[model samples]
Target: MASVRVEALTKRFGDRQVVNKVSFQVADGAFAVMLGPSGSGKTTLLRCIAGLELPDSGSVYIGDVLMDELSPRERDLSMVFQNYSLFPHMSVKANLAFPLVVRHRPRGEVEERVRRTAELLRIEQHLDKRPNQLSGGEQQRVSLGRAIIREPRAFLMDEPLSGLDAPLKLQMRAELKRVQRETKLTTIYVTHDQVEGMGLASVLGVMNEGELIQYDAPAEVYARPRNAFVAGFVGNPPASLLEAEVREENGNLELRGDGFTYRVGEDLARALKGNTDRVIIGVKPEGVKLVRAQRAPNDIDGVLDYTEDFGSTVIAHLRIGQGSISASIPPQEGIGLEAGARVGVRWDAEKLSFFDARSSERIV
Candidate 1:
């Protein structure tokens, strides 16, 4: 279960390049993830894929082998960090039999694979406790049962549940996606959160500052974001960006903004014909929906500016006429919109997205 890749992967520090030419791939057993925000080299690209940091040039395969000539335990791979480093006088069944007793195996097959990985990570009633008697999600399942008792062929992990606490990081993200799909293994997973990389990978790269901007899948990188740093970094009250202009009217391609004009749809107006005036528009906070009046294509009104319930969903914050956005409503129509209230937003010129206000790219 391997398949990682990563060409062009530069990684400097002396002259401050910190990761620049990054590339991506992660197929084999697939769980991928990466994500960003925080010095954003995403733990220096998961410490250069766990050989513990090496890339000054490129290359770091995994299934086909070339892991920069190996070491960090010959790069077979199994990392899991964010600190639950275990061993405080071991005993969660000796920390899952300390990696099958450092690979010597045979103590009755290391107590039958530590009683089947402590009953598949429920931590078998905290196996005889230690590491200060467990619980930070049982010392993160005894550091993921010492990396799933070394079944390693690949699994990297860096922000291993960033020290839990949002209901124990959502119950250790559904018990780490049910023990990575019952040991399918080939992981990767570094994180700067974004709901733990859209609730556990299966492909999503993203990264920033050091670059790798958008690898897709998690609703296609939150619906087709290819630039403007992935349409202002994947969504959730994030993609509003306005600053329109692109005219061409009679042939119909509008956009205009600062009060409102919009149209832009003959296939997004031929993908904004090289921006006749400026572009940017990107809408998505559930694609701007807070309606209760003025409706019939791209409506606009304004001044509601604030309301954030989130008990299921309610995000209003609009100021549309003077251009500012935000609208995720639906907690039964957010109990009839409030704060200053002059509402009427609408949005769906074929779900408008256009970009490139000076190379922020994606005009299609």
Candidate 2:
């Protein structure tokens, strides 16, 4: 296993910059996941590291070797693509053995490596089956085995589970995590799925509009985002961000919105001391409590716009003034919340996040 590092990497296409001065490092034997939306240049950044797309500037390093000029093969990395790029005509055994064979390893050694890899991926019984004959999950396992057989310096997986159904994807996710932990391979995985990224990564890098916005532990990124973009993008329902203005009401600091006003504590006030008057308040769905009765402090009355039940939990959507917000609640608590019903929305002040409206940078 080897650590992967990129320094000020920049990639551009014509007039548009696809990757802008992105820099981060994946420690040896650590799993780093790049999370972003579509068109966020995450895949392009991964391609740059794998030597599939050369960076216009800056440098990439695998262990101690600078790889700016090396070809993909010379990078000593195995890539598992989204489409499971396996040979249709080759059987599973041949596909797994192909990497070692091409390197001119002894036939016995290649067979032994292929056998071990197939067993590790739990596809040993399907060695003779061709790619076309295997199920989607099985085919993905074969692709992983092919990559594992070579035992490359690091693994680059670009949304490898995107082709599978929901249940199959979850199954493969667990399998992939198990394999990576067992081998301790330094793996960089790129995906638009926040759940997948958070579940699999020891370190998470969030990208947006061709820039690396935040890089940290998955929980840290979720709990304390560096900016408003990271705050909105990392959550499941995404944080509900409301535009507000900080005002000195009496002796206490208060955040006033169109239909809500929340008093800020001394700690929060200190964090927002130098910020502009205009601020953004971010509250995750779970942070918004749905109360049937009116409450003091941070409560805002709104009408229940809709509710979505996800078996065990329910999301109660509400319309406060002209803005829409949602609160995640237990199914039982949400049982009486009906559309157009009057409800009280309370913010969890302890979990509230404040951002500078102009710069979108987190202030508290």
Q: What TM-score quantifies how close candidate 2 is to the native fold?
A: 0.97
Clash number by candidate, in order: 0, 0
Q: State the displacement of the C-alpha of residue 25, model 1, in Å, after optimal TM-score superposition.
A: 16
Per-residue alpha-carbon lDDT of model 1 for 1-364, expressed as tens digits? 6888888888988888878888787888888888888897888888887878888899888887788878878886888889977888868798779877887888998888888888888888888878787778888877887786768888888888888789989988889888889988888887877777887888888888888878868788777788767766666666778887888868877878788887755666775676547888888877777667657675777778788897998888787666787778678887866688776788756555777788877766
Instruction: Name model 2 segments beyond 4 Å from true.
Output: none
What would you estimate as the lDDT of candidate 1?
0.80
Worst 10 residues of 1 by lDDT: 267-276
Per-residue accuracy of model 2 over 152-196 as CA lDDT, tens digit each: 999999999999999999999999999999999999999999989
The best candidate in terms of lDDT: 2
| lDDT minimum window of 10 residues, candidate 2 | 290-299
**TM-score, candidate number 1:** 0.42
Q: What lDDT does each candidate get?
A: 0.80, 0.90
- Please give the distance, in angstroms, between residue 174's alpha carbon in candidate 2 and its true position after superposition: 0.6
What's the C-alpha lDDT at position 243 in model 1?
83
